[model samples]
Target: MSLQPPVYYIKSEYIETDTGNKVSRRATIAGPQNIILGGKTIISSGAIIRGDLRRTGPGHAVVISLGRYCLIGENCVVRPPYKTYRGTFNYYPMKVGDHVHIGAGSIVEAATIGSHRELIGDIYQSKFTIIKDCAKIADNTVLMPNSVVPALAHFAGAPGQFVEDLPESTQEMVEAETKSFYNRFQPLES
Candidate 1:
């Protein structure tokens, strides 16, 4: 399969960083300093990244870390997972590996999402969920808390369950698709 058609956004609505990150002005990103985008990532319009929900400590902390060529689709909400430990509620960091895509309107509170994974549109990933590499969460799936998605699995349905194993070519396919998505996402011509 080939890349999708180009997605054009209004230039004034997005800020393209030197590292080729395209952040939409309409997106709500809390605590910018606490969030790290590795490069060539896209934060689409209406997406909300909660970097303010950080680990409770005395020192500086990174709340969210996203690797290269990732996409946070429109209206998605990404926040660090939190839990009570030692009688204290605390939020932990969220790490997303390279070439990952969180699809439109998805809500993610995952602790770690591995490389080349795709969380399809409208997915709800609960706290502390760990998604391994090359996994695909089907559209509208709802993952339970503390869920662990194995590598090369395809999960679907509410309280997501592994429905099938993905092909070995998933990694290459996902990488190419993510790269293509980034390349095609451009500002409208003046």
Candidate 2:
């Protein structure tokens, strides 16, 4: 497989893509196993991605599987346990859909974050934090695990409360903000 910068690792594994993707110098991806990243994905600097996704029977860990065209911010720590058991193993693999934007320093694991989920700040995501598509999680927001954030909902605050239904005006504003932020530091295409 062809890597953009061609950085070195002690022991790393990846799938051979027909087309190469550009991985920024600022990004830090590490793991003991394979780091599977899809095509056209931008992994910025300071982003910590762990590749160990499987469980040792009863022992748990966070496995992050992101879809295509995802933008994961800098300094983000996404670690969530996939299985839990009170005598029996609770198997729940973390899954993120396409076109999702996860902000910096956000800890995401457990459940399924649907497509187009916009999350910001520090999320103390639990084993069952299920967010639907097109949901907006404000900066510094924390989503308690097992709680569901409805689609098109506008959430804000430290512990993340539903401010109100996400209006079109608010959506427009968020879109604009997102566009501007990414534009400022757009990844270089190889």
Our model 1 lands, by Cα RMSD against the true structure, at 1.3
TM-score of 1: 0.96
**lDDT tens digits, residue span 12-52, model 2:** 22222453333555666655244555544556557776655
**Tens-digit lDDT string for candidate 1 (140-161):** 8999999999999999999799
Runs of candidate 1 with Cα error greater than 4 angstroms are: 1-3, 60-62
- lDDT comparing candidate 2 with the true structure: 0.62
- The lDDT for every candidate, in the order shown, is 0.93, 0.62
lDDT of model 1, residue 3: 43
Q: Pairs clashing in candidate 1?
A: none
